[model samples]
Target chain A: MTEEAPAPEPRPAPGLPPGPFAGPAPAAAPRQHLIVVRVRLPAHLRTLVQLEKETERGPGHGTASGPGHGTGSEVTLELDSPGTQSSLLDALETRYPVLIGTIRDPRTRVRRPFIRFFACEEDLSHEPPDSDLPAPVLAGTEPFVILGAMAGG
Target chain B: MSTIRVLVGTRKGAFILNADASRKSWEVNGPFFGGWEIYHVNASPVDPSRLYASQSNGWFGQLVQRSDDGGTTWQPVGNQFPYAGVPGTHQWYDGTPHPWEFARVWHLEPSLSDPDTVYAGVEDAALFRSSDAGTTWEEVSGLRRHDSGSSWQPGAGGMCLHTIVLDPVDPERIYTAISAAGVFRSDDAGTTWKPVNRGLSSESIPAPEAEVGHCVHRIAMHPSRPDVLFMQKHWDVMRTDDCGESWREVSGDLPSDFGFTIDVHAHEPETIYVVPIKSDSEHYPPDGRLRVYRSRTGGDEWEALSDGLPQRDCYVNVLRDAMAVDSLDPCGIYFGTTGGQVYASANAGDSWAPIVRDLPAVLSVEVQTLP
Candidate 1:
């Protein structure tokens, strides 16, 4: 029985993509365009984000010049044209690196607990992660915010 | 009497829900007790007018509030717990602040012997007794002794004392259930504790024993017989006739023994209600079905109520403490789920009607007929 059989490992086609051995090409760059980002922080995190001061202190804090708190907490992002979801989240994270891991994954893009996103004044809580946010929210000109989700009980 | 009030505890605060008989129109007065995470919201059983709300502020400590006018106003009950004032705090309960200031309370039971005698279980896996109402409190020193430092544990949420059963005839013969830790008894009012977990299921890694860490989610007693218990354990629903000395699995016919709350008839000892959700690994309604089952012969047979339950794919998981049966003659059964829907069964569990929906995920459901 020992001398009867020695199986050979299967081989892939020469050039027609090495089948199982071939690596999937990196995901194509997400379709991009222009949009706005908004975050709604609970009271404690709003203070953590200096949202009150950002609102009261005016656009001076909007520029990325210093790091005193939320002073450097702006998000830069890419979008799928004006008034879209992907674009809004992209702009928010690009401007705020600290928010990268705090909200969506730096790699996976999943929303984190205590962190929430809203668009067009409607709570888009259970929407598909990659779905377009909303037409009104991605105007790129309106004031958008990023904030934490506060849950209890 | 003119309004039905529903108390909601949120991450930031609590909300007071006011509704009329229809239970349809709702007015939400929310974000109450700002910045304090309300864990348990309860109304005095004898007088629905008086309200009790417990809050946990993590590092800051735990706080409780009392309302005299149906949650229209509030006052804080924080300084009652003195353990937070000490230095060497013995064994840390739930691996957290031993007698945490902000330690959450899972059960707020008012003594049947005296309305003022309140039993509260906190994060430290300890039970507290307030003899003279909420004015002052003393730790159940006796039960704490039996905690068995190494074996005691908390649930996924945390180490918690979530269930407190106060005997109407004799408050001294009280029972308390802690998550991760099994059920404990204090026949002499929290002075001494012992293992009342006989017959209960605890299939944790290694093996099961009388020590602790059995993972009992909730336990209920026949309103008249304090010794008789129905518990929604980690894996099964069980019963103990001789006051936790011996047990039997009542959920044998159930597709899954996993559930959060179990309600016994306020008067009839044989009738009980159990809402069986799948176990933690397959956490969903049983068989992916939206059913609230009732066992008329003490869990021997079950009948699912779907008269008003949604036919849609409704798989809302309910918290253990969120479902209850009131003491009304036929008994009033009410339950709330994580998906923000509340159901009421006017005539026991024969049929159920959805009264409130589209609200915030409900944490607790406490109901009392009009005074």
Candidate 2:
């Protein structure tokens, strides 16, 4: 059998440019768009996350009063791309890992029965998690509010 | 100098009571994780400074908090507890197959030798272990996957594995008790388990004396004699000598055999304690008097230790995990009430006094004897 010619280098499509833009362009580095979203947590969760932050700071630094002290109820989170309930929560849980199963079910990713999400005066708890957040929440004008429903005695 | 730290888990939060060796004059420090239900808070037997608290809310689910410096501060640890496979089903209240769903942890049993090792008994009835302190948890599937598991049903309170006793001598031997599934023993650590309810009888179930399906409220064992277990069943007090191979009724002189908590003395293996409620339906003391019955001979003969306790017009129910003992000279005994009072007896239940009153309804009480 005749020796098969060495496989030729695959050429770009007929009308495509021959340089860097030729053929299937190398997977572009994912555009890094950082969006800072504001989140207002319930008092209990605020305390829980604050305690975690204090533990991270180590002993003798818990209640050190000054500017940049006190992780208040309203937290600012920096998220990458596609700002939706899912992404916002993913970012929130990433920053405060302790809040993983609190706001949503860890296994099902469903909002807890008694936990409600609101932004721009609209109930977003039942909205699809992948749906984009309201403009006010995305713009940091109105915080993405996480309220523990007025439940229990 | 010896000191005692009473870790009290309440309906609303956790309170850490510190007292000198005298077990008097308490210094209460908490309401930690306030607005949440603290099911059980326990300190590591190997490392007294390490503590674990199960903080949960109806709205937020469950979270395990770890404190390296006692309860001065706490950091949330791993809360993910995924079952082994498929998660199967257990019997529901109406005798229908109910999917096993994780609710919350009812008890946390830290290892007797290793500070990082701990076990969590959670609702829907299963046992989970965390070898790396509370950072991660893996279910001991053998117990839940037992042959008789599907037949298990929940008591009035949801189906929960509420008690875990580790053998101090045999590291591989572990015992656990569920609300309605009775007691189970594991000789190969938590790898394999068997129902140890041989002699347990529950009228509530179709088979009063089945291999499983007895509502075992609590079980207590002394470290010195791990094989001898004292159990507080739903309607009777039980004692097993051969490591749960068989159990016999020890509810001899108890005013009402229905009770929740049972605990063995820290130093005296033969001395045990139980708080007898009026009945299963009425969760209160027998005659509106809160009394703690002490059985110095290990049960069948009980004496009401109501010296400092309320003798009249007092109604409170002590939860299954709400009593504990300290390893001191006199061997202090402590129990909390659903009426928001934690009572302590420095002289091993001869008398009792409230260490703190008017707090939230206490859920569980644990003691750590610190050097």
Specify the highest-TM-score model's number.
2
> TM-score of predicted model 1?
0.66
TM-scores of the candidates, chain A only? 0.47, 0.65
lDDT of each: 0.61, 0.85
Question: What is candidate 1's lDDT per residue for A23-121, written digit by digit as tens?
Answer: 111244244543334333334434323444355534313432222223333433344443334445665546543233445544346564334454344
Error of 2 at B147 (Å): 0.8
* Stretches of model 1 off by over 4 angstroms after superposition: A1-153, B1-31, B34-36, B57-61, B84-102
RMSD of 2: 13.2
DockQ of each: 0.03, 0.29
Docking class of 1: incorrect
The digit string of per-residue lDDT tens for model 2 on B1-371 reads 99999999998899999999998899999999887889999999889999999998787889999999988989899999899999989999999999999989999999989999999999989999999999999999999999999998998889999999999899999999998999999999989999899888889888899898899999999988988999999999999999999999999999999999999988889899999999988999988999999998989999989999998999889999899999998999999999999999999998889999998999999999999
